[model samples]
Target: MNQNRVQASEVAPRAGLADISILANASLTSVTGTDMTSNAQGNYDLALKYSGTGLASVGVADKKVLVYALPAELQGKVVGGATVDIDANLLPITPGDIPGVKVLFDALGVTINTLNAVLPIPSVVAAFNQLKTVQNLGAYQKTLPAVVSADGKTISVEFTQELSEYVHQAYVATFGSLRAAIDALQGGNVVTKPLIDGLKLAADKLFDVIELIASGGSDILDLALNGNILGDMNGTLHTTVSDPGAASATVKAGAINNALISADVLTAIEQEGEAVTLNFPTTAVNPIENYDVAAPVITQPVAGQTQVAGQVTLTQPIPDRTTFEAVVTLPDGSTKNVPLAADGTFVVDTGSLVDGQTISAKVVATNGTYTKDSPITTATVTAAPIENPIADYNVATPSVAPLTAGDPEITGQVTLNQPIPLGTTFEAVATLPDGSQLTGTVESDGTFKSAGVDQLAAGQTVTNG
Candidate 1:
């Protein structure tokens, strides 16, 4: 026998060998055949030769070196000859070849028959198809919930754990000491200066945030959440995570219960009853009850007034238990607190004030717990001008005229030693011998005429009255 180089195996004895079989298998499961040989057309042709066998028993037509050829890697394991078929393509085979052919046939889930059957071959192919739709997922969106009362006065917010964590991170980033303190606290360390400072800083930051949210809108909170949309009560989304949107959260403010107090300078008089009255406008939301209102205003002196005094009236009547005060800033800049009467009125003496000096005044109402003040008003001191009354006047002799008609008349002009005012009036009286008197008033041009005077003789005395 020729020395076999590939492997030394038993060659079938001519007495026992009835057919030829060939098997090709790789040691590794994957295809790593670097020495694969193929024809120019990319077809792998493998030839098998056998000799000196019971070839006639195997139904060999001629014993002159029978040869069989098959495709490399295409053929399966060798076994007893049997019928074989691949994708409707058949090969000459016997019952013994069925096992080896069934390996490839059964792997493709195809079937074959060894007796009186035409084989059908199956071809395998692979392909990749394009998808009809695709989707991209990114970070999740977040939102902070808040509620506002109907009156739009008070607003409350509940922070989520995620939001709280974010706030903590923000605090730590803003204050370096905060991070250390937090770490120490997490590590169960004792309180220290840094921890106290951190706590103060955190409180301040929290208060600032609260104030901002309370005073302004929640645009800041929305920004912190990195969400474009705010959630509404109706579950409507207002913003998007990546782009700006017109979504806003609803925050209804409740009616404010506290009193809305305000005051103004109503009347600032510098006359004999010099007084200032502060008026508070009417409020509907929060009534002016259970509260005191005060205002301080500067009152300037009137043209001829010398004293300053004031009063205040609230929209609501002052409670009986409330105490009122008027804080007066004197012309010398000294201040005095004077009690106010139940009528919300007060008076201040201006004797110490000089002419043209300004005084500041303010009124305050207090109920022990709550107090309100009016705006400041100024008052200036002034004195009335001096004047002397007229003492005497001159009366000219009366001219007697007989009335052409029914009654006798007396006519005369009254003159003053000192010029009296143009509008001043003087009276003239004429006494008759009968003890009756005739009187008349002076006219604008300084003439007086008495009507219905007693008839007198030419010499009868008609005295000027």
Candidate 2:
């Protein structure tokens, strides 16, 4: 042994294919050898011969083996299974095989036509095509983890920071105008020109626009924008009275004097003290006729009078004697009580008024328990005219002849100291004993005869006519 012993290193280094061990009693018949090649597709074939009839297993039985053409750093690391070649089958790497690599690729592959089938929206398809051209798309894809279902029908994508950032940017770009509009609305910085023009248009066709919106649906916008705002302008719409400081009944009368409302419409509302109630009519028509607040008609104090006669008369009777009083104001500014008669005649004797002095009078009516006053009517007064009397006139007594049975006529003669004027006409009036009156006309000579005396009785007496 010491003479020719071979070292194990030397023998091991020189060992060839023939020196390789095989199962016991199993022998190699022949091997088709090929030249060693550096190409990945290089192959070698071996033939085996066995003398024994028993079967022999090749490689490890009932064991899964994985072979990966990995880099030098990951040579021993557990990777994809050799049972199914990942590259040959085009299967994606899973997190189970590689702790960090989560990939799911469809066997059919994803294409633009496939995405177009899923998303029919043209804008979405265009956006997807644009996304594929982005320079950072690969970086984003690397951060996204996908999972394939066991059934191989679905691919679920897990949320990732890169995906989140991409989604946020997409949302902002898509809704940029909407976000700006909302901000403008919140800040009350809307464009005034367009708003005003739109408002004017709506005002012009308010009913039509309301009808259109109402036909849409029954939501809050329908009710607030159309139903509540566009209905009839009746009831409390045009006229609503509220008293914040006091009770509703304590509001002052005439405080709501809208010119559109007539006095008759408000007459029933008490204008006086507390507890005054307003009773509006169901209809808007004014019920009272000739409703007015005109001055009272004064009928006395005749025009163009030389004397100051303190008398006043109204065409119509006073409404209430208890609440009204007539007064005559003298030129000296003194007032006299002018008692009103039931017939509306009033007399105020400012005894012996001075010549050419003017007199004025007014009737004042008061509201019961309320200090309010009706319109006062002032009477027009004028001075009474001066007069002259005739100095002398003759009076003649006429004698009458008694009526006889045969002579039914009663004759009488009247004498004046002066001759009557040529154009003057005379008349005589007589009173009979029966309290009846008889009339006769005198001739130019002043003598007159009564012919209707035929009805005179015996006890009846006749006087000068």
Which one wins on TM-score? 1
Tens-place lDDT per residue, model 2, 1-465, is: 653465543453432212221112322121221111111111111111111111122111111111111112212221111111111000111111111110111111133234335433244334333322322111112222233223322122222223223322332243233223222321212534444333333323422332332343222221221111111100000111111111111111111112222233233222221121222223222211222223335444544432333223442322221344566666677987644565555655555545455566566544333222235555545445544232244557887765665555667888855655444566777776677666788877888876665566666666665
Off by over 4 Å in 1: 1-306, 317-320, 382-465
* lDDT at residue 15 of model 2 (Cα atoms): 27
lDDT, candidate 1, equals 0.36
- State the lDDT of candidate 1 residue by residue for 70-189, as single tens digits: 111112312112211101001112211123222332322211111102221111111000001121111112432333223322222222333333333332233233223323332213
Total backbone collisions for each predicted model: 61, 7
Where does candidate 1 have its weakest 10-residue lDDT segment? 123-132
TM-score of each: 0.23, 0.20
Q: On a 0 to 100 scale, what is the lDDT of residue 199 in model 2?
A: 30
Cα lDDT, all candidates: 0.36, 0.32
